[model samples]
Target: MRFLCILVVLFVGLKAFSQDSVSVPSIDTTQHTKDTLTIIGVGDIMMGTNFPEDKLPPNDGDFLLKDVESVLKSADVTFGNLEGTLLDSGGIPKKCNDPKVCYAFRTPARYVKNLINAGFDMMSLANNHAGDMGDEGRKSSMATLESAGIVHAGQMSQKTAIFEKEGIRYGLAAFAPNSNCVPLNDLQGAVQIVKELADTCDIVIVSFHGGAEGAQYQNVPRTNEIFHGENRGDVYKFSHTLIDAGADIIFGHGPHVTRAVEVYNNRFIAYSLGNFCTYRGISVNGVNGLAPIIKVFTDKQGNFFKAEITPTYQTYATGVRIDMQKQVIKKIQELTKKDFPESKTQIDDNGLITYLAQ
Candidate 1:
């Protein structure tokens, strides 16, 4: 009887092992169609009245961005901060700190071709510089952006823009911390609007101009900034909250320097991209241009699976030429390495930081 019981137990054990050894079929995740969406974003583009001589020919005032045409065209979508109005009228009222060098920018309506030629699909008009020319200037900016077929968001109409590509829908929203610019008080409403768009679209990208200026590098979260004695923005908590409400990518500016990069819930957030093509006389503020061209891949269901980053630099002077820089790649990696821990990035010959998602 004992021999019979032992035989039965051994037989059951063998059956269990056999069942465990049987292989289960793996799901073909790669079978679904995949597409790579490359998004190139830049910092402040102060292409205004700094040049007294280049008052733009009547038909082509937007010619300032002619030099970087090839570079801009390489990307699928290009975005930047339109620092001034593009209208032909509206004279300057309040003078800048320097009179001989006081800055007020306006361009002919036709120069938008330069931006289109530079591969710009969209821009953010919610900046301090946008209203520099007053209500008329701001109105002119809106009209110019529309005329150029370039989509913009900020203190303008339709806070959220719905853009479709490759059969995928994307929502873009721009915000700031003040009414004069992108008032911080409007954040809750903006979040709600963006969240609604996220629900209906595959991805949502939010751009903001905030944080203090100068050589300061540390992220002073929760603290609001008062630029020129006027409230500018509240970046820290506002950004994280936006992520919670459903923002896939968040690009920040106004710091005039690269702040930091973090991955939250598989989404990418760049605290500050620094100066892109700000030809303002300030040298230090325009040094290492760290605008990143981010490429993202999402499933049909809008689930972001991977991304890459490319870094570029701009020389701030008469010739606002942008050059690809290698150190910028190392800087971003080193900055994000501690937070991501497994963050890995490589710089290509063209000075693009290709970050591998962990």
Candidate 2:
């Protein structure tokens, strides 16, 4: 097994777990003596939802991440937001305020194999659609990822995840503004989780589903963002505080568009990674299709060393494809320059990231 996953008991309809820390038993997991480690993080992923209809891809959706499998596998740890539920059938779709705007994704259970093939080690389950099938769906999703040996945390049930991969222990915590998820607005709670993880693992990473949605909300407001009457939480303050609390990396999503990238206190943060493999229900028009993979190289102490941004895009028919134009890369550069001009990190045309000269 690539991970030593914990057995978390989560009952259907149960709220978020009250505890922030989980104990890890020591093991001889370090097989490599590398000083540097690479981690790749992507945005939302709903491989193929079959809730309202049968929109599964050709060949059972196994080919969704095949094109970029090698790139994804190149990292020591690969992370993505696992949107929606993973179940063949059962569980009721949550009712939406408006039928026209309601979207609930129900991906097949066997599709976890595709993620394994693509080298996904960790997944975040604290997004809006996480409760698409209500609590039952959430439990099923957690169970599926566990069965696949993929470490996941975001719900109150499992707010933190610790696993050993490549001989290094990784701790991840996820947050969202939605109910049942680790509240993104709860900054203190989030800090406690990160602090605990940092104390236990070699690398501590945080995943958040915050900020407003669509292309217009791409910029981090640096303050609390209210979207559609819902407080999306100020991603800027939240990220910085987590970093201060000992988070090594912060990966933000939910804007459905790529946002800025920054290196704060030598820790890397991607405001929003945009949609990765969302198919059918989610729109892929214009910039929404830009699915750039964030590949960060960090030292053993979890300090940011450098990074690369591999630009890619997604299609409703297919899944993910290489973007030769590097449109997302350019978009990130433009956004980062505009959103965080003071950021020490610089992006080159070839998608390399480095610090500016002193």
**Candidate 2 — worst ten consecutive residues by lDDT sum?**
6-15
Residue range 1-358, candidate 2, lDDT tens digits: 2242322212211222344344232223547688889999999999888888988887878878989999999998899999899988889889877767568999999999999899998899999998999888988998888777787889888888776665677889999999889999989888888888887678998999999999998898999998777899999999999999999999999999999999998999999999999888888899999978989999988888899999999886667999999999999999999998887889999789886634
C-alpha lDDT values of all predictions:
0.59, 0.86
TM-score of 1: 0.73
After superposition, candidate 2 runs with Cα above 4 Å error: 1-28
TM-score winner among the candidates?
Answer: 2
Please report how far candidate 1 places residue 92 from its true position, in Å: 5.4
Stretches off by above 4 angstroms in model 1 are 1-34, 50-68, 91-104, 180-182, 218-223, 226-232, 281-290, 296-307, 316-325, 337-358
Query: What TM-score would every model get versus the actual structure?
Result: 0.73, 0.92
Q: Report clash pairs, candidate 1.
A: 62-111, 176-182, 177-182, 177-183, 177-184, 178-182, 178-183, 178-184, 309-353, 310-353
Global Cα lDDT for candidate 1: 0.59
